[model samples]
Target: MDAAARDAQGGLEWRVTVPEGATVKVEHEHGAVARAWAWLLACMVMVRSTVAGFAKRVWKIAVDDPRKAVHGLKVGLALALVSVVFYTRPLYDGVGGAAAIWAIMTVVVVFEYTVGGSVYKCFNRAVATASAGVLALGVHWVASKTGELEPVILSGSLFLLAAAATFSRFIPTVKARFDYGVTIFILTYSLVAVSGYRVDELAALAQQRLSTIAIGIFICLAVCVLICPVWAGQELHLLTTRNMEKLAAAVEGCVEDYFAEEPARPAQVKSDGYKCVLNSKASEDAQANLARWEPAHGQFGFRHPYSHYAKIGAAMRGCAYCVEALNSCVGAEVQAPEHVKRLLCDVCTRVGTQCARVLREASSSVATMVSSKTLDFAVADMNTAVHELQGEMRTLPSMLTVKLAETTSLMDTMPLFTVASLLVEISARIDGVIDAADALATLANFKQVDNDDDDKKRETEMKVHPLNESDTDDEASPENQITKV
Candidate 1:
């Protein structure tokens, strides 16, 4: 799920590149050495896990909580130690299989860094990885039994798997579908190795490589878990929070399209209702600000839990409802010929406004508190949280656009304004939090520097007068004092 990064369009997520670099190369190369490679790589890993560490470091930097970086680094180092001790044992002993495993581990760490969102975290990653490992093991067994890793067959299987993964989400639950899809891809890859396309030796070699891969996973898993202590979730939370803003921005783009188009009667449109509002496609003009939910990149959000993704998911759902309503009401009558019917503006005044208010409350809920409350709790304090009680709150402008669009569509007349003003309000609201966060982070940084400077100044004075002895005025008064510096 973390692999599902955002495409340039930013609508849905896509796969991210594996962060393979010097460390991964060196790890694999070291593993390949005749002997003592593990020790050598251990002394100095092939790769320094920079790419792997980038996301976390960036998150901390953004939140002005660099101190967390130290803890993260410590955890990473410990995981590395564990990996070196466990997975690299066979290689260190005689197999001299160090390089490939090291490379894979580095790759895994990089994947961890790049991954984002709750679906990835929905099921524990350890569980996912262990399951994937078992799957890989199983696939390898199948290959051994079948004596076939056919290119055509594997390719077809992969295609079907991808297609199925995407479409199957319509049934059962989204989380299960996503996890199953992930397992499919993972198992498919595992089967490739086990299918004996080449021979048993290759399978044997693959098995060894797989074991080494497991070592890297252990390190990555351990390291990933350790970051929470350092930043206290401040940094990672902000990163996802920014991603949420982007999602809101995406929602706004649709609303803007509604406004930018021709204005007409609010009531005489030809559509059925507000269902069209949920259209995932944004206008072609929105080049810069189009992609909404881009947070699905690598291990970016893996440090946190699923709650972050829930916000994004909520936003998406809100968008969906807005779209559905739009389909039903797009191009509807704004002014009644016989009587004054409630227009889109009224909905804006009520639902969207209410959502904004709820979102605002949600945003402010945390600025005053410092408890171990869940992120969902913080989200509940927002205006959109009105949906919590009613099953659907509409702080989003697109939803209004969708409804208005549907109304006008049905009536065969465009409204004076199909777009709602709430998008700007939502954007403003999100920006408000972002601005406050930036300011707070800056202030935090400044205070940290100030304190560090004060500590240093104190330290300098300590060096000049390091003695901890209690001062006594009675020690011969002025005669006891030394005049020398």
Candidate 2:
């Protein structure tokens, strides 16, 4: 019946006919919503203050070896699921619910895309914060439509919203964008049909629900600001950074060992380089865990601040190993100086190919990150430089080919100095690129957030009401201050 009313012109006419002194707080969210904002701030501070370690770990991992860190998303996501389950009390309390969240997040994600962000690309906060706003609006709309509260409608709406969110998981990240406003619209319908709340009371309701809304924001922000940085710094200085130094030492040692009077074979060098790459990858993972996942203080979140810094330190090591592997491939001739072998050539080709691929992926991640941001000044310079380095990665094959040909000119001469020199150069270049990108990203972290505390998770109205865009757009812009309840 409510759906029919939404379809028909007069269905919701009564909502607009407010009494002389009825409450409406939309036009002035800040006027009465400041109290709710404080609560939200408190919640955010408390949660972030608590989860310092988790955020640190996530940052560490992202920097150390983003490729490996990406692979571990399943574990991160699983833990997130567990956390979500533990927080279900908010749902029964009528403060929050899952489907409502999904609808909101979906709308935010889509809105970001419309405004030039690529969904699921680089700007994680935009997606996350936007989602929060979406959920708030969706829930509020539903409450307005219904004349009385009906858990069933909200519940069903939640189920549908969840389905939509789940579907979003499978979207081709590089393809067309999706907006989940449809789900929010549906939730709004559910709430309005049974929420005993009149359409006109939405502003007041948003104000009334301030406590719940503030709490959630506080939770997310606290995790980011209070905990992860310090521990993450140490983790990088120790594990990842230390491990990289060792990998460098090992590369040099292995090359010398393979060549000493004993006449080592290409196989030994190849195997050793492979081992270093694998270890480098693992270290990157562990470091990211410490940096990106760990919250600053609390043990509740998945981030491990220390781990993220360690990952960056470790990735730097991996860059070193790539150089070593390339060296070992080229150096096998001089070290073994004995056995008739074409084996080292094969090793060089393989190592170079693999290292090139890694750099390519690394470059792509940066580009994607750039595309996701509304403001690029924070990272533009770094992005441009690293982009060039990433490009240099592809140039490795040419350099190697020229060196190999030069070695061949000797007609049985092993390219010892030539390979070593090239390996070192490649390693240095790649590492330099990764380092610059990491540092720039670190600086941008502080700038990611806009100053406004109340992030309006506005819904993308698929079907616009008679209300003009001006009438409906009340969310915060970066320039304006918002006090959402």
Candidate 3:
């Protein structure tokens, strides 16, 4: 059987079915004119959607971040300038339309939001374009001398160059900054070489290409620097500070709620806490990489503290790990005795306060480029909080033994002491964060205060911080330590 279906738009599609040992006869036909019109209509629909999408995005950007509007304006002005220069009387006649397009493309390609980024791209494109032009000229000269062999030589050369350019993207350093340049290099080289074969004036074509590329690079750099420039470094600084604040909030929320009497939390709050931590890690890492291309401006010198920023990010992840463990222990699977709970609450309070202070101070320092010596005081407070928590932790085993002794069924009560052991592990991770923060402060060039010798003994206390309660529980089950207690 043969069947045809008509779409809502009156387009028809045919289907045919055949049984075993039977031949199915079907007709599938559309006039060339009708098919062409249908394709045109489809193209029109796609064009409409594309324009609508572009307009919607532009409106969204204008509303969300007005500073980005300057980028659009800059691009429009540069494009206008390119059109004027290339379409004008003397220049248009001098450099033909074919040659002018590469110059215009350079304007669209090289311009970037940051002055440093634009400048870097400008120089890279210029070098790649000029080298490609020269190499293309040499290849054209070789092919011309070969006469009938020209096609073979040119085709082989293009194949080799294209393969090489494609493979170059896999190189780590090239993939980072120059991958786009390599692609553009292959394109420019092919265009020049192929066009040179057809055009009588190859030298003039090469000269015009190099000149046009230079014009584009110069104009993009000038506009990026002279206009309302958005420095990548400044953006990175703000993002890093904001990420710190977000991390601080998440940590505080997790720690505070975990130690609360009612451990039950709204699902949204828990989800948001972990989401913020995870999102900040991804955002901070990307921004750090982009910031590497930024030049020194304002407070930063030629060499910025990218390494310190990375270390801070790593420390934040460590803090998030501890928070996750705390969250895991928050349920009825773990419980703290009244006295130990109070001590844990006190530690959480101190840790929260010091963390907030450190975040504020760090953010302020990043913004103002003024080193805060008070971070030394904050770190010291965190260290003390960690030490006091460790002291409480030392007493936990004995207290748990006593508590276990009172219970008739040790197996039923074992989960409660897991909270105590988890608290010890959390304290050690917190101490690590404090140490990392101190190191980060040093890297930030903060004025160092005299180290308090008293904390040196407290550092040794951290060694006992990891109390693997699982092993303890297992050993207790086998040896009947609960019975001994």
lDDT, candidate 2, 1-485, per-residue tens? 57777768665645555457655565356556887889899999999977997888878978996644543443343335434523677552454343334322422233210111211221343343345445645665664467465455566666776666657656754122333333433444344434555444654454433433333333333332332223432333344333433444444445444444554554553335335445555545433433443334433233323333444544555566555555455344343233322334323332333234334434443333332122221122223323333444455445546655555433343344355345445545555645654563564342244434222321212112122112211221212212332
**lDDT value for model 2:** 0.42
lDDT of 3 at 479: 21
lDDT at position 417, candidate 3: 42
Query: Model 2, which residues run further than 4 Å from truth?
Result: 1-156, 167-230, 263-318, 324-409, 415-418, 421-485
Candidate 3 stretches greater than 4 Å from native: 1-64, 196-200, 262-264, 267-274, 280-286, 328-343, 400-485
Q: Highest lDDT, which number? A: 3
Total clashing pairs in model 2? 91
TM-score for candidate 3: 0.70
TM-scores for candidates 1 onward, in order? 0.32, 0.31, 0.70
TM-score for model 2?
A: 0.31
Off by over 4 Å in 1: 1-91, 94-96, 99-210, 227-485
lDDT of all the models against the reference? 0.39, 0.42, 0.64
Model 1 lDDT per residue over 1-485, tens place: 34334444365555444456646566667667846766677656534566558876788685795545565565457455655544556555533355344434433333333122221332333354445445445544454465455544445555665566556556555543254435544554545533645455544555555455555555554555444432223433443333333343334333333332354344422221222323322311111111121242332232223333333333434544543343333344452221112333333333333333333333333233222122222233233322321222232235445665544343322232333333323433443443443343333231122356545544443334321113321221122322222
Cα error, residue 483 of model 1, in Å, equals 59
**lDDT of candidate 3 over 1-485, digit per residue (tens):** 22333654356465456566655432223356678899999999999999999999989989998878888899888888888766687876666656777678889988877665686677678878888878877888889888899878888888899899889999987876786679778988888756734435877777877877877777777777778888776776676666567655665665566567765565536324535655566666555655676676766667677656666666666766766665665555446554445644665555554555566566666666555544555455455555665676577566557765564343433443454445455445545545655565566565433556435423433333232323231222212333333
**Better model by lDDT: candidate 1 vs candidate 3:** 3
